[model samples]
Target: MATLNRRRFLALSGLSAMGAWLGTASVLAAERDAAGLLPRNLWTSPRFASSPFTVGVASGDPTPDGAVLWTRLAPQPLEFGSGMPPRPLLVHWEVAADPQMRQVVQHGASLAHPELGHAVHVELAGLLPARPYWYRFSVADHHSAVGMTRTLPAADAPVDLLRFAVAGCQHYEEGHFTAWRHIAEEPLDFVFHYGDYIYEGASQPGVRSMNGRPFTNLRNHVGEQTYTLDDYRRRYAQYKTDPDLQAAHAAAPWFVTFDDHEVDNNWAGAQDQDGTPSEVFLLRRAQAFQAYYENMPLRRSALPRNGHMQLYRRARFGRLMDLHVLDTRQYRSRQVPIADRTQVESPARSIVGAGQEQWLFDGLADRAPRWHTIAHQVSLGNYAREKDGVIVSSDDQWSGYLDSRRRLLEHIQRTGQGNVVTACGDAHRHYASDLVQDNRDSGIISSEFLATSITSGADGQGEDEFARNTLRHSPHLRAVTDKRGYVLCEVTDKHWIGDMKILDQVMQPGGTLSRWRRYAVEHGRPGLQEA
Candidate 1:
């Protein structure tokens, strides 16, 4: 793969009329073809009869000397009661510094039991930090597809540069994953998926499924929705089979969290916005959380139990970066009704909950890094507006929890913390804003870079127009786009740059990508500027 040179990229784009620059779509297509050098027929065929491993391999939660590698034993995957045989099977895993797995670094055995859904999570330790590793799993004589992963840098190392991508909101029935196909080709250290990994309900009418296939429900969702353990597991299995998503997972390790759609849209705590009891809802939450943990390469410590999962955690990338991941949906207050948008500003309402708020403040105040990145679910900027004497508030974002947002901003400013950049994914549009101490105030404390959806909402209702209008109204906002794609960020000692990659189209196949905009934040300056 070729490295992206900012200077050359800018020069070529400036002369795009001369045909000196290739569009992102063509370049990405070429890269994808190159990466899949193996014959398509050979790659897709079943490698084993009874212990088939259909889903490709993946890894995450990387440490300096280790990382977790993952795979599922789909002996007869997707068929009813066919994912695994009734008997226990032994699975072998290996890690190496190279793709061919010649120089083995770690090897282990994990028993695939029917009780745990026949999935494997192998955590490997004692590897080098800031280095790439390759791994795969084997059942009997058949080997799973090879996967690539990497570890974070040491806590105090002075790193020169760090590269990563952030995206969320992939509704499987809405569109093809051409964006993921493109992102899989980028040379990135890791991928941060901010939430809404899969939609709980089956495909609604008017939503387009990938590869011209109908949106088939694999889980036969109970109550005509997804809530039970069987329902949740089936939904995950359906999503895990996507070729584009699988490719992206194989490309790099991922850090993930969930928003409401993982269970239901706009659900909070034990009561939804409608003020109804959530006893059944809580039971559903437990099953969904468990299924999520079973599929991802998360540590066992983050497992779900009795309808609750501990997802708020931190990751350090040498001395250059510290990532504070947030789980906004699990412990948040009830969603304010549409009629009570003004009432949401009350301090009683919480987004991260009171306890989690203190945890975040303590983490931010404890140590100073070149960049303090927050991996959060919803948009933090105030996106409310008024037109024709009528007020409109997004019931789904941090705007619905105004007091918590204010407290977070005040804490950062009061502590004099610099370079606090938030990487968000929930709203289906891309946004870059300077989060001021006060939106109307002249003083700015930090900034935010929001990425668009991976493949959600079938191009988002009027999102492009909304983004343009938002930029015009808010002077702090640098740029906005409704295109479907992800954000690739590169952080250096003195500056942090965001590349907004926009897809050509989401409702169709073979969509291409292009750098829609570029913005950079200088040291000690919270505002953004076009690069």
Candidate 2:
């Protein structure tokens, strides 16, 4: 490794982010082994470290040729500063063609800056498409565990099959992450964690007891609601230390987006549920955003800038699928009271914002692939509950943004588009619904499959009155279940199959899992059918 100039290192840190790449685009454009791309002075320091890869390694935002590799140096994951001093560390990384890690393809050294929680994000370019790559991190002689990631198929190539898992809403204190452990064992090409990776609340005790031990006595959040950067960082560290969550990350590359719990419960665009002043909440939001970016294996494009983050982006899997990942919370109107939500269906009400909505429209207008799937945080279909024999719209979901929802469905119907499906999270229970212009008989414009929580709802009953009443009032909802698990999706040219994997219990270790239900949406078809 080469030496780094302290002055130049400090200068680069002050630059602003422009777009897909960071402000240091010039450095990223250089050759793989180019010196100064990352500060290397820390490699020779008397304070050089060992065992820095305590938080494990992760990779995400895979493209046709490459992906982003992530790892944070933390020997003491729960401690302040993660047991590192206020300085950068020289972190070496590599990409290999095989799991044995012998056929090295790409290798480089980068700085794990203390400003970013001693985390190193290495974005690699110029690798083969539609193939798996293995990666790992090293700080001096201490090596991190190997992680596997795969690049998407070439944009124009024809793809035959793609398999992945969809999951989210993992509250740490609720129960063990048995769902993620099972998901790790599946043969998946990728994973979708659609928000709520960490809940933004103080831990609850005695409310949940597993294996005869009360949760209050087991573990809890380190502080009050996360209001500072340190609070959010420590909270994330606590959740990331879970062995099962780590195992799922090590299994395959992940594509992630955030929901309410990531920052605060039911926060909408610059507004907190409890009405904290915008100026004050913006600072909290900034801290939460930074912590989220530091921990996840996200590309620089998703990095936080000036109290905001860009999360919505597009990914492709050859000609078989085009995924439009959305950010529903960042640019949406505040949640309205149930009585007023239905009346506020004006064109001004937006869930995806104008720019992102236009992007979605343009993507749909273009010649599309066999499957058009929207990966978002909330349910798109109408989910009603029976209150005194009256069905009411859910204000927190898409139903509240009535005009936008209608326009989206109308656009699909006008274009005669087919095979449009949505993979959703946030709701703790599993729900499968058909998206239509109005009622179920109005014709299905799209389909939605909601993945249940990983551990947010501990030891959930397989069936409950909530499910029974929801199904009774909402005809479009094909299936509903109260369980903790994920949804496995298999996409082929002719059919898209979804398997709802439900866990019997999350309160204990080694919870048993089973396929609760299976649904299929055929090519040129809009709604889901029993597989």
Q: How many backbone clashes does candidate 1 have?
A: 1
Tens-digit lDDT track for model 1 on 1-531?
223243432322222111113443353344347553212221222345554667677888888877777787775556644455444454667778898999877665554445457667776677788999998878668888889999989888889998999988887766787788887899999999999887887554443363334443222322246767767767777777778889899999998888888878788887655455688667777778877887887876676756778889888898888889998988788777656846678788888998889999988886657788889999887664555666565666787887888899988887785778889978788888888644346387888889989877555443455666666666677777677899999989988888888887777788778888888988767778788
Which residue runs does candidate 1 get wrong by more than 4 Å? 1-51, 206-224, 273-276, 338-342, 438-442, 459-463
Q: What is the lDDT of residue 26 in candidate 2?
A: 43
Against the true structure, candidate 1 reaches a TM-score of: 0.85
* Model 2 weakest 10-residue run by lDDT: 14-23
Instruction: Report each candidate's C-alpha RMSD, comma-separated, in the order given.
Output: 13.5, 4.7
lDDT of 2 at 481: 90
Q: How do all models score by TM-score?
A: 0.85, 0.91
